[model samples]
Target: MREVAFIKQNKEKWLNFEKAIFNQRFKNPDELATLYIHIVNDLSYAQTYYPKSKVIAYLNQLAARAFQKIYKTRRQETNRFLYFFRTEIPMVVYQYRRYFAYAFILFFAFVAIGAVSAAYDDTFVRLILGDHYVNMTLENIENGDPVAVYKSGSNWGSFVGITINNIYVGIRAFVYGIFGGLGTGWILLHNGIMLGAFQYMFQAEGVLWESVRGIWIHGAMEIFAIVVTGAAGLILGAGILFPATYSRSVSFKMAFKDGVKILISTFPFFVCAGFLEGFVTRYSGAMPNSLSVAIILVTLGIITFYYIFYPYIVNKKMTLHTYDSTL
Candidate 1:
């Protein structure tokens, strides 16, 4: 690109940096720091292509000033942990909202395939859910309790074990994204198939409502966290597959960090899911229909709002704060 065109292309960005950085007057220092990174990159570009031009000198000066603000801000930062959960993760989630959409769409598609295949093939459920599980569930059904497996373990024991297992599954789903997202998709595929087949088994047994009321007390958040983790994995995959304007390494680093943030946000949800699974799901079969349904809806609503709706709300608030800060 010509120096004139390059300058024209980035003129607004440079102006915005000046406006954002000059006074060190922003509510979100993290965003300001991100802007500084861009400025430094622009400085590098100018130094390479416009070494003799005033743009290099200008950008260098902006970067130097911004560096001081970022440095001082970091040393003084007190609410970093709270800010991470409150502002950082939500911003990251909003920035990568489409990946969540893509992940969920792919998950639902895989689930449909699982369900349709099970419907058409008698042994498909056994193939996916394993013989031992099918036999155990069948026995539970014969005894008038379809999900009694959850009742076996002691409450605290169940909670600890289930929490650990859920975290493991979530981590596996996220780390697999290092393979460029296919790994994450495979995890989704594996889990989606199991879920579909599991549900179809209940439906075929003529106790669909019985199973739902029994399972969804905890399944709501458990499954939702799995899909959210899948989205985190896709973010990793996107980092590797599409670096966009960044070098591959830089893109991967950014994606990995964002993915980790996303993964971190899910830990509480997993814990909550595990708690319900251990303490509540075992009783779901005997609970009142109204109570079971309310639990299901509430659990689903909490996770749905956090991962689906809350990101937009948080992002808008941050944008407004940024705009107001500029004024």
Candidate 2:
């Protein structure tokens, strides 16, 4: 490309970046880092292709300014943790909301498929859930305690074990995205099928409502985190498959970073789910119906509000902030 055309092509973007950096208008450190990476790439291109041109000098100056702004010592924000959850993660979520929607749709479709298959074929549930497990659950139901499986261990021991297991699952879901998302899809499909078959077993035994009341106490957060982790995997796959205007390498880097952020955001919710499972789910049968329902609804509401609605709110605020700065 000619130097003149190159300058003309990127001139507006460079100016906007300059304004963002100088005015401290970035939403978070990740956003700044992303912009800096792009600017550095542009600088490298300019140096190689137009080394003697004034554009190279201009880009060098801009890149230097961005480096200083990003890396130079500055006063630390007092509420860095608060800002990350309140602003950073939500913004990233909003940016890739489509991935979340896709993951949800794919997972639920598998769930429906599982449900339909189990309904038609009596043996399907046993096949998916394993014969031993189905037989054990049948025995538990006969003993008048369908969910007694939850009370098998000490509360604190259960909490620690469940939390570690859930975190490991979340990481696996995210890491498996490197296989171009197919691995992640398989994971979702397997889990969805298990869930559908498991629930159907309870329904077959005429205790569907009882099972729901006990299981959803922790399943709300636990299942939601799994879905979000699936989204992270899809994002990683999309980065490789659809590079858009950026080079494949750059796209993958950005996607990996963004996906990791989304995955990390689910850690707290996983911990919450584990805590509920260990401390609350075991006693779900003893609790009043109203209390169990309340716990399930509250957990679902909090996760829904944070992952779904909160992103829109934060993105709107960011858009308005950017518009005001332009004016």
Candidate 3:
């Protein structure tokens, strides 16, 4: 592509970014990141084909200016974390909805498969769940404490171990997307099946609802994080498979960066899931059913709102703004 064509193609976006930088109303990290990506894309091409061209000089100047303004504003406040939840994370999630859908579908399908298989085969749970887990669960059931599995770990220890392990698994699923997303999907399928079988184990014993109220108090978020991580992997794979308008290398770089960013941003959610599982889930046996039900519903509601509703809201707001940072 000619330098003129490149500039022409992105003239509007560059102009909007320029305006936002000066105006400051929309010059958040999101916009700055978008501008940085655009500038780098242009700079990379220029350096490759026209290293000595005047266009390269212009791009460098614009990029430097954008960076200076971006770093100049430091709004330190007690409510920084509050604002991040209210704004930042939702934007990132919105930008990657396709991957999220893919992960959700993959997990849902596998969960269904597990549930159906366990329904038909009395020994299916034993096969998938291992002898140790099945025996422990049976003992708990006989002792009138069917969900004691969650209570076995100390709060702090379980929190740390579960958080680290889950985050590790999620990241591994994402990293495995390099093998064309098959690796991530396979892991997701395994998890989904385990979850389905685990649930069916309780249902077979006539404690499905009870189990849900106990397990899903934390599993909702934990499972959601896993799906999002899988989405990240698919995002990476898709970028490699479908470069679209960009060159293959450019597409891969952008996709990898975006996928990693989305995964890293879920750190807080993962920790929260672990905390709930290790601390809150342990107390489910004693907590009021009303309270447990409320927690599960509310947690599911929040998940639905953020991953589903909030993305649409953000996309709508962007359309109204005439320039989405996602572009």
Candidate 4:
């Protein structure tokens, strides 16, 4: 593209960013960072193709101004931390919401396959869930405690161990995007199938509701994190596969950054899930059915609202803010 066309294409956006910066109209630092990223990209392009042009100088100035505004804010470090969770992750999630749907669809499909297979063949549950796990659960069921597996370890020990393991799993799901997302898909498939088969096994034994109350106390958040991590992996893979206007390397770099951000954002939820599994799930058998169901529903609601609904809310506010600025 010619310098004039490029400048024309981005001029309004740059002006809007300028207005945002000078007027202090940014919704959050992440919003400023987002605009700065685009400005810098344009500046880089101008410098490369129109080395001696005035447009290059103008973009350089604009980008420098944006940088100063972003970093020189008076907000404390605490505010920055809050902003990351409050605004940054949600914005990123909103930007890549489609990937979330894709991951969920694939996971649900695998879960269905596992459920149907287990329903027809007793051997299928053992095959998917492993002989050791199936055998242990069967023994537990015979002993009248189908979910006794959760009660085996010390609370704090289980919390730390499970938290670390969940984080590791989430990270692996994200890093596997290098394999063009197939690795992440495989991870989701394996886990989803295991989950379905395990549930079906309990259903076969007439303790499906009992199993759900115990498992889903923490499984809601744990499974949601896993699925979101899969979305991050898909985002990374898509970047490599479809560069769009950016070079393949640049696309991959951007995707990796965004994907990593998304993955890191799930760390707190993983810890929460681990805590619930360690402390809450172990007591599910003795707790009232109402309490167990309530916990599961609340956890699911929290994760869903934050990851799915909150993004829409934030984006709407942002859109209105942007439109107001233009007016």
Number of the predicted model whose TM-score against the real structure is largest: 1
Q: Give the TM-score of candidate 4.
A: 0.79
User: What would the per-residue lDDT of candidate 4 be over residues 206-318, giving only the tens digit for each residue?
Assistant: 99988999999999999999999999999999889976545788679878988998999999999999999999999998999899999999999999999999988866665
Clash pairs (backbone) in predicted model 2: none
- Candidate 1 residue 67 Cα shift, in angstroms, is 16
RMSD of candidates 1 onward, in order: 7.7, 8.6, 9.0, 8.2
Instruction: Please list the residue runs of candidate 3 whose C-alpha ends up more than 4 Å from where it truly belongs after superposition.
Output: 1-88, 323-327
Which prediction has more favorable lDDT, 1 or 2? 1
Order by lDDT, highest first: 4, 1, 2, 3
Answer with 2 or 3, whichever has the higher TM-score. 2
> In candidate 1, what are the lDDT values of residues 143-231, reduced to their tens digit?
99998999997999999999999999999999999998999999999999888888988999998999999888989999999999999
Per-residue lDDT of model 3, residues 188-301, tens digit only: 989999999999889889888878889999988889888888999998998899765457886788679768877886677789889999889988989999999998888778
Judged by whole-model lDDT over C-alpha atoms, candidate 2 comes out at: 0.83
The per-residue C-alpha lDDT of model 2 at residue 170 equals 83
RMSD of 3: 9.0
Better of 1 and 3 by TM-score: 1
Residue-level lDDT tens digits of model 2 in 34-136: 6766776788898899888877656655554454444322222357687668877777787678899999999888888888889899999989988998888
Query: Candidate 2, TM-score vs. the true structure?
Result: 0.79
Those runs of model 1 whose alpha carbons end farther than 4 Å from true positions after fitting are 1-8, 11-78
